[model samples]
Target chain A: MPNIKELEDLTTQVRRDILRMVHKVNSGHPGGSLGCAEFFVSLYQEIMDRNEGFDMDGKGEDLFFLSNGHISPVYYSVLARSGYFSVDELNTFRLIDSRLQGHPTTHEGLPGIRIASGSLGQGMSVAIGAAQAKKLNNDDHLVYSLHGDGELQEGQNWEAIMYASAKKVDNLISAIDLNGQQIDGSTDDVLPMGSIKGKFEAFGWTVIDIEEGNNIEAVLKGMAEAKSLTGKGKPVCVLLHTIMGNGVDFMMHTHAWHGKAPNDEQLEIGLNQNAETLGDY
Target chain B: MKTYTYKEKKDTRSGFGAGLAELGRTNPNVVALCADLIGSLKMNQFIDENPERFFQIGIAEANMMGIAAGLTIGGKIPFTGTFANFSTGRVYDQIRQSIAYSGKNVKICASHAGLTLGEDGATHQILEDIGLMKMLPGMVVINPCDYNQTKAATIAIAEHDGPVYLRFGRPSVPIFTPADQKFEIGKAIQLTEGTDVTIVATGHLVWEALEASKALHEAGISAEVINIHTIKPLDDKAILDSVAKTGCIVTAEEHNHLGGLGESVARVLAQHRPTPQEFVATNDTFGESGTPAQLMDKYGLNSAAIEKAVKKVLKRK
Candidate 1:
């Protein structure tokens, strides 16, 4: 396994990929992508028990689904960096006919994506189903999924939440990026969901909170604990308290960059802040 | 005229249940999911036979669709059962993104389709399901005629590779088709031959079209009858060939005239043959509380309606 320094370097590199990809397209989302760099790096490079190659039916291997798929920039970077595809393919992000769509999808046969999810709140149900499939196949493997905290307002997530515990689906771990920011404004100002932790607990889930979601070590540890909590008669949820845009100083602490791409000057500043640890695509 | 008969009658939902039960014993990869309508969809037989393969996803149709799509990730063929309204309209976005767009192999078996759902009113009866499903790029829209055909179509779709929407009704229709007929997707069944006017019908209307043919024969009009089981990937050749012989056509279905099988046949004819066609379907309106037979007659979805349409089209020809 990679040490703390190597993992942090990978996260920084992934942040760079996220910024550069969005900058090139002038359309893709960058805020949520930057916020999820550390978690994606830690999960793919450290946490997940993945197989050597990719297949639609990921038998006998841990599966991951990206519920909040607007963060495709970070997902594509981490997938490419982890050898699912060439990192150079990140250059094709959001171009016509490219596998890397603005949102993640299996439509173009993108190697890592199992479902199309730009429409939020459907991922938890999908994760539960995959976990159930693992049980039916008698394959001792877990299924992991990622979602946005603001996305829980979609109503379908509650159905899945109420269901996962009722059915005792114990082989699934879902992480919500509690960035607290959405397109219009902060989640609090838009529509408060009272308490996410309380909500999951009330729904009978095993909830874990990562105080520093942007920190690679914290994300790794939180996810590890999440894995340990599986197979205990309830689904697992990790509330990751992350900044909307973590690496760049200007983009941080605001919802303006939720779907907007960085201009040339802003892109330069963002790139300079996160020095290229691994070479650029 | 070619005559048809049936010794017994059964609801098409029961056929779906019987087919699912048979699949449980044969196809180990086949799994079933229902959104709190086991009795309504007649899925108890399958659930009883393979309890492990059945997922009772209580009252949450959107989650059921998403779960069915996810179940396909591990190479499992998930057949989601629900009322037609909840199956298509309530979860269209879920089906479009997860199953149809992602190209997941899920069989969305919907029961109690069209006005024959009866007494539940417009809220439960979905007339726009075929149009909604066929609008998705890769979705296969199928509406079988009777119990035998519904069962065969259900089993046949398991061998198919992508998303499919199998539509059946709640009423007990006559079982005229053979017991061991080979079910073919996208292939239309030519029930009878004629030369004056062609009557093409689907779902509950196929049996009515055959009856219409008999009445038209008695009226000295040779009306050809065709059963269009699959609506999308429509059997254009069958419609075109029959229309080539017969000058005019009458399209019938248990759905609205706007986006039902009639509109599909009109598109094919407008492009290829430009034949004069009359639609025997409900106008853009909602159904009210009534018995199945009462609703059929009220909405003009019976054999008498088809006969009237055939006569009208014959006059135009």
Candidate 2:
């Protein structure tokens, strides 16, 4: 399931493994990990169902949650090119016994981290409590999340988007990365969330906007219409429209590469825009 | 000196809805979140006998502590409930990043907590939730102390394995400890054995350190209660072997002698047995609208302020 020119050569080798793992751990957060490299390479190469051996209680599949964890270099380069761990441990991202942590963590048990976020709006309440524990283990599966529209002015992500729309939770699917920039600048002059899709449709959610979030076929048609608007009870939210530093053209539109790093000649013009595909960690 | 008789008093949030409906009928991965304070955290009998492992979550205590830290990611065991000041200072960084730095077995529980939540003063009284859940890292704080040790520390923090907080209270006091004992989490519970001081205590001040150890065993000054009920890995070898055979210590708690359980048994008796303690608690202030017996006698936290802090730490030994 890989084409858009092999997902733009795996989003340019996940922005050259996020500028060589944040310039060899001189620190991390390369502008929301290169503006969330085509939404984590179109959700781990064409929208998640995932399970090539990465189970930390992912029971019967689909589960993702990186609540804007300072985008650990596009989530450790699409979890080491979608295999979950070693791509030379992405050269130890935030080093010193790194399970790639500068933010995402499960205290190093790290087989696709079940939890431990960079303390933002708590990853849509841990993906609506893992989609309410996959509907109490009957395992209908599906729970994904991501955030950082200036971490949605964090009031605990509006108390987890008003508790996944008053408990309907509908298996879950959340997203934001609206990249209006942050780390101290334009989130509308810092804090103006005015009309974040009218604040998640006034907190009952089901929103969806994706104006080509760096276009991996419009992020797989806005994540396949956010998974057919999840089970149809409620809880959806999309809004993508990224570019915090998308494929690094001079680290795209400001916020000074959100958490800097690109030194060696801006990581060779951010690895010549788009080519390395699946090799280069 | 036995005389302990209360037969009926209840409200340790209905012993956490009768220990979460007996851990949802013997743990089928025992769930239950809450937030909208389901009848003030009594959790309507485990949301009426497990309505598919109950999870109302309306008031959103920081997204019910991140969906009880993502329902411990598929292993379930959540718990949550609310109001010990919105379960520890309104979702303390969503329970310090989705349940204590992601150790996540969840269980926060909490009820009215200190100053007995009477008339909802000091904004639903919390008194520093066992020093903000025992300074986090790995967490397991517990508070219990009545309604048979908060229904045996809510069926022993559902066999423990990580982030717990438990706590309890909200008026109707006296139930007197043993309704079928066996709770344990971090041990402690000595109860009587005396030798001059060592009061110690915990939640609802362990019935004010068993009425200040029955008034220091009727003034002959024996006093040795103990009962910490787990305030984070702090059994410290039963508090340094009961302060090395009771040399001098007092404690008690309805919380707030800064990070309570009397500053974690005075920092484990000042880093191992340098004794002479005292505390009895609540002196750092902040509680109002009386009657949890006049705010446990205006915050001295009753049983004659743990029998005057066990005669002021046995007159500094």
What's chain A's TM-score in each predicted model?
Answer: 0.99, 0.35
lDDT of 1 by residue, B1-317 (tens): 78899999999998899889989999999999999999989999889889999999999999999899889888899999999999999999999998999999999999999999999998998888988998999999999999999999999999999999999989899999987988999999999999999999999999999998888898898988999999999999999999999989999999989888999999999999999999999999888888989999999999999998887887787
Q: What are the DockQ scores of the candidates, in order?
A: 0.84, 0.33
Measured with C-alpha atoms, the lDDT of residue B164 in candidate 2 is 87
Candidate 1's TM-score: 0.99
- Candidates in order, TM-scores: namely 0.99, 0.41
> Model 1 misses residue B216 by how many Å?
0.5
Q: Retained native contacts per candidate, as fractions?
A: 0.70, 0.86
Q: After superposition, how far is residue A149 of candidate 1 from its true place, in Å?
A: 0.7
Root-mean-square deviation of every model: 0.8, 17.6
Number of the predicted model whose TM-score against the real structure is largest: 1
lDDT of each: 0.93, 0.82
* Deviation from native of the Cα of residue B55 in model 1, angstroms: 0.3
